[model samples]
Target: MEAKELEAEILRLVREMAPHLLDLLGVGPITAAQVLVSWSHPGRFRSEAAFASFAGVSPIPASSGLTNRHRINRSGYRQLNRALHTVTLIRTRLDPATKIYVARRMAEGKTSRDAQRCLKRTICRQIFKILEPPNRTRAASLTDHANQLDAI
Candidate 1:
């Protein structure tokens, strides 16, 4: 297939895979697809923290006596990290929420790079939430239905 044709087909598949994620501000088709591919089965991750760890966004302990700092994690899915970075960069420029967050972090003595890292971490959490399966357990749904039958 021609490069342009292949690109178009991939974009189409990405849209079909996660239109809601694609609809999110700052998430392009590629970014949406990356998120979907990295988290094809969200149930594998028990929680957002697990997702963050999988993406290498969870903060690793770096405290040393009185001094404390977290180090940049150079592990996990690099493509996923890149996707989150892309979303963070776009949001820093366009999304009001991210702008406010970055500005607040900057005001609190964080450099733009640090603030962006923090924002990317935040994006990881959001991605996990978007990708994670609904919290309404099957038992809860059945219980609710049983209660409705009792009332009836």
Candidate 2:
């Protein structure tokens, strides 16, 4: 299928499963699907470290005798980083808690870029949680049913 066609299908499925979530967020399923597809590549990152690396949020450590410094990791999916940064900015603007969190980070001496990175990491984790299959929970229930059958 074409890109637009696939996106439409994803939107349709999302609408079926979560009509209210989309409505509450003021976004159609197409927009949500686009964001999910941007972050949902399989075999991409196995751990948070890998995800942070891929998102360009992981800090690079630099140290010498009696001196140490950390720099932002810039080598990663620039598109993914841009997407996450954009989401962070939008979330901070719309979510009061996120705005306060950003302010607190700044008060703690974090630069604007550093605070944005922190926001991006939080957004990335939320995206990860949303994309994971709900079937995993149902699978656990199915396993319990099988155990009951064995007990019988």
Candidate 3:
């Protein structure tokens, strides 16, 4: 298999798997596929911390003999960072809450990068919230109700 042919094969497999992946995530196939693509790349994040660093959201600690400072980790996957940044930018434009949050951070004297990092963190939180599992206990209650009806 030539490199180009291998690449094509991988892409075909990804397309086939995308819908199932979306279904598992409980999201529309297109949206889930888009998220997967954004997070997928060679040499991309290997863990959440790495992804956080890549998104320029990880705080870098600096401490030296009574003087301490924190800064953004300026290393890791630039592509992922850029993707998160694009999302943040779009959110800022469309979401008034996000815009206000950014503005408030800026008013608090945060640098532009710092403000952006804040926005990125906010976006990450939202993403995680969407991807988190819902309560299964509620489903169990419905099942219990159905069982009672069956018993009657």
Candidate 4:
């Protein structure tokens, strides 16, 4: 059908646009596109924490009477937050490393929801990295400069 073909084309474009993001463990075509659209320029976020805040996944404090806790965030980009939730579900169910992390966090007295929030923050960091432009290391830049001078 025409709709299926259009969907396939869109997916193809998204894959071509962000192969690195697509390569991530839990990033499907739709999730990658949502992330790319939400974070058109990754540099806009000062840090991964900032990006998580923008996505509405950053933990907010909810401490009460010496008991430390946090409540679910319900602000910021709801679509981006949904995308992150989708990633968390995929990783929690299928990714072994994430499974281990969830178990470890649960052992440390965190509820599954808390553990998932932690995972979403981590996923946001990873998404930021994938979207961020690679900066040349000092040594590499120096070597490139030396090579340019030699060529000159």
Candidate 5:
């Protein structure tokens, strides 16, 4: 079929660009390609948080009264968010580490949706690290920089 052929071509291209993305538990070739396209260049994002915000995986504070909770961000690149959501869904069902993480979060009183949001944020961070060029500042340094900015 033509669709199968196209998918194969896409997989080949994605493999040439960032094969490691496919090694990730929930990422298929299409999802990898989507990530590659969206994260077009190194240094495009100042920090992993910035990348996460762009992907709409950043948590927004929604705590009120006695409940401390965060909500999913409703802005940014929806296509990318959908890709991440697809990855999150796959991982939640099939990835052992992700299962453990979700269980741990649930044990800590987070709802299923909250656990998934956390996982998406974590995945965004991982993808950012992999996509970042080696010459750029690593996430720890970026986090420190963000912290310093927060202090100012």
Candidate 6:
């Protein structure tokens, strides 16, 4: 298939899999697909922090002297990281909320790079929440159904 056709197919697949993810600011079909590929399954990540770590968006301590600072993590799944970076770039340029967040971070003394890192971390958390499996276990669902039967 042609590139445009392939992108269209991806869009269709993404819509079927997780249409809600596309609602997030700056998340296009390509980026959403990358996320799904990296995530692989609902329970792949134990927590948002784990997903952030996988994406290399979790900050690593790089404190020096009395500075008490962190640095951008330079390792993890590079393709996922690149996908996140692309979303971050698009948001920074076009998303009003992201622009305000970055400005606020800058006003608080963080460098532009630092602000972007923070945004990426936030985005990672957001994506994790959207993609994570529902917390209700099978037993919980069964219990709920039992309760409903009793009520009926």
Better of 3 and 5 by TM-score: 5
Q: Model 2 lDDT vs. the true structure?
A: 0.66
Question: Highest lDDT among the candidates is held by which one?
Answer: 5
> In each prediction, how many residue pairs overlap at the backbone (N, C-alpha, C within less than 3 A)?
0, 0, 0, 0, 0, 0
Q: Give the better candidate number (3 or 6) by TM-score.
A: 6
Candidate 3 ranges beyond 4 A from true positions? 1-34, 37-51, 63-68, 132-152
- Point out where model 2 deviates above 4 Å: 1-10, 13-35, 38-44, 62-69, 133-152
- In candidate 6, what are the lDDT values of residues 31-121, reduced to their tens digit? 9999999998665666788889999989999988888888899999999999999999999999898899999999999999899889999
> For candidate 1, lDDT tens digit of each residue in 1-152?
69778777778987776667776778877788788888875356667877788887777777799966676667879999888888887888888887899889899887777787788788887777776657854466567767889999
lDDT string for model 5 (13-55, tens) is 9989888889888999899999988998666788899999999
lDDT of 6 at 44: 60
Candidate-wise lDDT, in order: 0.78, 0.66, 0.59, 0.83, 0.90, 0.89
Please give each candidate's TM-score.
Answer: 0.79, 0.61, 0.52, 0.81, 0.86, 0.86
Model 6 scores a C-alpha lDDT of 0.89
**Which scores better on lDDT, 1 or 3?**
1
Q: Please identify model 1 stretches exceeding 4 Å from their true place.
A: 136-152
50-119, model 4: which lDDT tens digit per residue? Answer: 8889999888999999899886677879899999999999988899999999999899999888888888
Scored against the true structure, residue 76 in model 6 reaches a CA lDDT of 90
Winning candidate number (TM-score): 6
> Best to worst by TM-score, what's the order?
6, 5, 4, 1, 2, 3
**Candidate 5, superposed: residue stretches over 4 Å from native:** 135-152
Q: Residue 107 of model 3: what lDDT?
A: 93
